[model samples]
Structures are given as C-alpha cells and as structure tokens.
Target: PFFLYLPHTAVHLPLVPGKNFKGSSKGGAYGDWVQEIDWSMGELFKAIKAEGIDEHTLVLFTSDNGSAREKQGSNLPLRGRKGRTDEGGMRVPCIVRWPGRVPAGSSSRALTCTMDLLPTVAAISGGKVSKTPLIDGKNIWPILSGKSKDHPREAFFYYQMDQLQAIRSGDWKLFVAMDSKKRNWGNPEGKKALALYNLAKDIHEDNNLAAENPGIVKQLLAHAENAREDLGDVGRPGKGQRKAGWVKKASPRLLSR
Candidate 1:
C-alpha cells in the first residue's frame, strides 16, 4: 500500500560507522560500515514485523554498481572494476524478498538492470506505465516469483556516459570498437575495438571469442546500432531520448529553515 525508498550513504566514500558499530568489524572502517548497514536492515525488518505488513511487503536490495577498485572492496573473478565496461563494473547483487509470494532461498540468473526496476515495481503495485516518451524497462515479477524461466529482457546495452560500450544478449556480451582512456583499468592499451565473451562460460571475460564467432558479433553489432538509433551513442543523438528540463539561473534552497 506504500512505497519506501531507503538509500544509505554508508559503504561509500568517507565511511563513517555509528558509535555502537565502530570497530565492530575486523575489516576495519569498510567492514564497520558494512556491519552498520546490516544493523539498519535488522531494524527495518523489526519495524516491518511490528507493523504486521511484513507478509505483504516486497523488498528489493541491490547496488547501483560493483565495488570501486579504489576502495577496499573487491570484485574478484570478474575482470575490470567500477569505471570500466567489464563485468565487474556492470554486475552487482540483486536480492528480492517477499514472504509467501517470492519463494524463500530461490534464485534466478536472469540478466536484469536498474532500468527494469521501474516497470517491475509498477507491475507489482498494479500501476500502469505511460505510453508516451517510452520506457526501457520490463516487468520481471514473473521471473522473480519463479513463475517463468524465460528471460524477459532480450538484450541489455552498456554505456559509459553517452558512448555505447557493450551489449549483452542472452549469454553473449560484445564490446564494439571504441577508443578508451587509461582509467578504464584492464584495457591498458586503451582500445578494445572488438571483443566478445560468453558470460556463462567466461565470467572473467579473459577469452576473446570475437574472431571465432563472427555471426554473434554481427548480431550484437546490429543490436548496438538499433540501440544507438533509439537511445543514442557517441556523436549521435537518439530520437527516443526525452529533452531534459532546464532552468535559467537556478538557485539552491534548503529543505528546512
């Protein structure tokens, strides 16, 4: 009946744990912050049970991106880090909890992204998404509820700023030709131009199969082209992109006096 978006500033830069949680973790400041978040979740569940809405609530826990390489976090087994287009930069944990609705201890490997949250939440709440301006999200409740095995998303495109970086369709992920800077991490040469990986088999993205599988590369390229037409890429503006509202001489104001 209600929606609560609780975003925590912890586990980010300037890690500051509560006085009670300070020095509680052996991993130092980062671990202390993690423990603090764990405590926060416990408090939230306790409140939910007290309100008797625990059974009706559908909770989703996820992160915007993988751990920052500069931080004490690790994205082991996956190549590259937060700023790159590698699996490490794009992949993050997504946990859904709904009592009696979503089966406990059940998991799905269905590829999903942050964009899918809009439609999925809308579907779960019995809300309708507007037709105009378009939406790139898909309802994934069926996938989450274990009612469907099919992938709701056909493909997911990756972008670093306005540049289309990669495309993932099914198990295949293709990185098209593009120049990169040194900060992209793994790709020290600063040019990946063309690369392909079967994520199911090569989660580390070490083996490049782009030469062996030309057909797949071509298919993913076509998908990328289509995305560029709709969502845009470097040097090109997408037709589907909505013009952002701007204010002339905008001024900041305090939320409270």
Candidate 2:
C-alpha cells in the first residue's frame, strides 16, 4: 500500500564522499561515490528485510542516462556519451526484482524506457492513465510478470532538443547525422551525414552498414518519419507538431532596494 520513490544524489557533480570512503576505492573519488551508492542500496535492502515485506516489494533500479564523459564513467563497447543518440547515450542498465512474483536473476534484452515507468506503475496499482492526451509509454507489466517473452516496444527514436537524430528498429539502428561526437547539449543542429549499424553485431557501432542495407535503411527512415509526424522534429519541421498551452507569468513589481 506504500510507494516510496528514492532519488539519490550521488555519482553526480560536486562528487565528494565521506572521509571513511574517500581513498578506499581504486578509481578515486568517483569510485568512492559509486561505493557509497552501493552501500546505500544494501542498507535499503536490509531495512526492507527487517520489515518482513521483502518478498512483497517490487524493486526497480536504473539510471536516467548513460555515463557522463567527464565523470570517468565508462560506457565501453558502446558508442557516444550522454547527450547523443548513440547506444551508449540512450542505453542504460535496468534491474527489477520481486521475490515471489518475479523470477530471480532473470534478464531481458528488451528495449524499455523511463517513460514506460508511468504505465507500468499504473498497471501494477490497477489504475487507469488519462487517454484525453496521448501517452508515449506502453504497459510492460506482461514482460515484468514473465507472461510475455517479447516486448511491446518495436522502435526507439533518439532526439537532441527537438531534433530527431536516430531510430532503432529490431537490431538495427540508423543515425541521420554521423556528427554527434562532441557533447553539445543544447545545439539544435543535427549532422547531415547518415550512418547505420546492426546493434546485435556492432554494439560499439564501429561498422556502418547503411551502404549494404538500403532496404533496412528505408524501413527505419519510415519509422523516424512516423515519429516526426506526431512529434515534429526541429531539424525538419512537420505539420503534426503539438503546441503547448501558454502559461502567463505575473508582472514584475518595482521595489526600492
């Protein structure tokens, strides 16, 4: 009956750890911070066991994005960093555990996003999400329950700001611009070059197959176009862009300092 959302503020900027853990880790400060995060999770699990509800709780652990380049975090065997549409930027680790309900130590390679959390939680609580406005998330409860072996998600669209940069369908990923190397967080410009890779074979995205797979490229392009129709891209403006309701701000009053 209780829902506790814990958002930890570790492994981020101003990365300082307690004195006891400062020089204990091999990777220096960031490693110490990571150690603290692990210890914190262990303590949380201990507390849950103490409450005698460990088997009844569903625990999901994940990060918002991939490792940051400046944080000494490694996203090895994957291309690009945080702020890019590459696998290393979009793909993140996800772990879910429910003692009796979910199978222990089972892993799925299915594509899932943080947006899916809203619908997943709603499905678990037997609540209905609003249909007046469209929701981009799909119910992944079936996958979590092991009732379904396949994921409902078929495609993933990558974007920087309002620009659509890449699309992944099946094991194939296509990037419209090959120039997302540097992290320009707010830049609206997308690279003009095109690139493609089969993630199953090239998780590092070292090989470009766009030239050999024209049919696949066309199919993934259609997926990107479909997304643009609903959520118009800044790089290529479309007619289907939804406008946000304007919020009026209060007028500023002049006061003597």
Candidate that would win on lDDT: 1
Model 2 alpha-carbon miss at residue 197, Å: 0.6
- The parts of candidate 2 lying over 4 Å away from their true place are 177-183, 186-191, 235-257
Query: Could you give candidate 2's per-residue lDDT for residues 25-92 as a string of tens digits?
Result: 88878889888888889998999999999998888999987778856588887887887777888899
Residue pairs with clashing backbones, model 1: 177-193
Which residue window of length 10 is worst by lDDT in model 1?
180-189
Encode model 1's per-residue lDDT on 3-114: one tens digit a residue: 9998999888888888998899887888889898889998999999999999999888998877786465788888877887889988988989999999899988888888
Whole-model lDDT values for every prediction = 0.86, 0.82
Q: In model 2, which range of ten residues has the least summed lDDT?
A: 178-187
Candidates in order, TM-scores: namely: 0.93, 0.88
